[model samples]
Target: MKIYITSLLALLFSLVLNAQNLEKYEEMPEVDGVYITQNMFELLSKIDVESDDPEEQNFVELIKNLKGIKVLTTTNVEVGSQMKTDVNSYVSSENLSELMRVKKEGKFLKFYSKPGSTDQKVSQLFMFMIDEDTSEKRFVVLSIIGDIDLSEIGQMAGELKGVPGAEELKNIKDEK
Candidate 1:
């Protein structure tokens, strides 16, 4: 019984630590971060939308299952380097599989995901991007947790317009 309790507590602690991978960057002056909680998603799902379009309906359904989203961006060279390392570590530690990689318009984007309920769905989507066009290089990390439908990811990107590196989500091709 004692062993069981200890194991359960350890599991909960690791889950929390994994969830807060990007939290440290939130308070840093050099990092721009945005965190949207599960409650916000719940509220968004409750909004009444009288749309007959299948695509629109699918978008709503997608939003309903989302738990949260965390975004961290940095233009400082040092911070950007650190973010790259942290993103790599997070991906490996979380055992996320590489979904895709895109390099276009002076930006390099890499996506990773954790398995979901179905082949077309993902429990978590993680993105890391580096922009080399500007004099000051920019790095971005975006983590989304939920039962996400890969087919509707483009809609998610549209909804999150202006979020750094979100536009690249449209490029994801659900290959197997």
Candidate 2:
């Protein structure tokens, strides 16, 4: 009986891990507006720059450690709604902690992260956001994975404010 119980527990644990696997996203068919594993960021980071701004240099240093990124976006009403539901369900089932949530002007942003070697570091950062502008509604799911420095997230956030939902990155920066 004890052996059976142990086996059942192990099976359940494995199932949970599989359910949280982000690799599945990579296999998903790219929707009209959704993108996956784009190299744009890496290419942009490599530009030869002669600027003396410490902030600019700092931004470059932050991206140096980012190994992989995935992003999906949709403007379709049905798809956007479904994506939000799917992401929320996945995040909860995976037990990723909610680092921050911001709502403004009918837009919603949420940030989540999975811990790394130490409490101060994160191996993955995930974001889900819904934006309602005058023209249309946009839903986005973004995941960043690598050896992330918790302290530098704020600087990275500053550089990424132009991107949707990236502004929320500042809230969890420096948190252990």
Strongest candidate by lDDT: 1
Model 2 gets an lDDT of 0.72
Q: Tens-digit lDDT track for model 1 on 62-161?
A: 8899998988888999988988877887788789999888898888999999999998889999899999977878998888899998878766676768
Q: Which residue pairs in candidate 2 collide?
A: none
Worst ten-residue run, lDDT, model 2? 29-38
Cα error, residue 103 of model 1, in Å, equals: 1.4
Clashes of 2: 0
Judge candidate 1 at residue 120 and give its lDDT: 85
How many clashing residue pairs appear in each of the predictions shown? 0, 0
The candidate that wins on TM-score is: 1
